[model samples]
Target chain A: MLKPLGDRILVKVDEEKEQTVGGIVLANNAKEKPQTGEVVAIGTGERTPDGKDIPMTIKKGDKVIYDKYAGSEVKYDGQDYLVMHEKDVMAIVE
Target chain B: MLKPLGDRILVKVDEEKEQTVGGIVLANNAKEKPQTGEVVAIGTGERTPDGKDIPMTIKKGDKVIYDKYAGSEVKYDGQDYLVMHEKDVMAIVE
Candidate 1:
């Protein structure tokens, strides 16, 4: 399990395609991978340039929506994960 | 256009339903909305509890993925938008 640092978060992406959602059964070459994901871990908080602490508004187990193309992607323990800043988050599910 | 402040970011959510990905034509009640979005705007950066400045890694025009349920959604000019901390961002698109 990868733990994010700072105000960064780690997410496990949900599969993009499902049989119920599709009709054509597109092959892997044509299938588009889902860029969306679920929150797996959250960072401690933000740090000031001067090394001060900034409180975070989000916590673990929260679902969020963000820009499709943001943050850094890394593979750990044979699984793909994302690590990014909290500011990149855009909305919370109700 | 909505301007995000601090480490907050604004995103324009893409529609969850698309013909290419589905077959059943699930009704609105059964269809799941896509929590993912595109970055429309970005905040200046993060602020320390003491009010110091913290540089942000993400910039405007960057796409990202975040927790499915992580931000505040606001309607501006009849368009839906999300505002959240940058730390909430989990990944950046290559």
Candidate 2:
């Protein structure tokens, strides 16, 4: 299993970007990739300056919207994943 | 100038990814973009829980190495830039 360390969170991006306004597939040649994804795993929370463990707000299975390029992309088990810091995550999806 | 607001930092990625491993230009079809850059600009300090301004550790013109794919790429003024949060910044290079 691919587990991210520290404040890194592993995201499985939802690949739903397949249409365009003109009903043509958008140019993948320049697209920066998707930003929305489901949390497959989360790293341990950050340690406070006082050495206390700050619990992470996000959990596994939480759908999140992050910056499009805000993480390291890695390949594992024939699947692609994004390892991002918690702060890079912008909002929690409903 | 492309000034990133909040904890966002603007990085001018060093375009040093034009070499070959075996003297053959690596395949651009699957390789990710570069991960090293110079901090062209940095965001304001983060707000602490007590409302104090926690100063940012990074400064402009500092060379930095960040996780590959860990920022939103934007084209502004005919140049490429990455907008990444402070926490996404991994290490400061000399």
Q: Compute each candidate's TM-score over C-alphas.
A: 0.48, 0.48
Compared with the true structure, what per-residue lDDT tens digits does model 1 show for residues B2-92? 7888889897776665544356564454633225567888877767786776777667777666566668989999998888787676555
Chain B TM-scores across candidates: 0.76, 0.80
Q: Which candidate is the best by DockQ?
A: 1
The i-RMS of every model, in angstroms, reads 7.3, 7.6
Going through the candidates in order, their DockQ values are 0.08, 0.05
lDDT of 1 at A13: 65
Model 1 RMSD in angstroms = 12.9
- DockQ for the candidate 2 complex? 0.05
| Candidate 2 docking classification | incorrect
Q: Give the Cα error of residue B44 in candidate 2, in Å.
A: 32
Query: How good is the docking of model 1, by CAPRI class?
Result: incorrect
User: lDDT, candidate 1, residue B92?
Assistant: 53
Candidate 2 local lDDT, A1-94, one digit each (tens) = 6545547788898887676867777756575654799998876666454434468889999999998878777555677777788999999988
**Model 2 Cα displacement at B47 (Å)?**
24
Looking at candidate 1 chain B, the ten consecutive residues that score lowest on lDDT are: B26-35
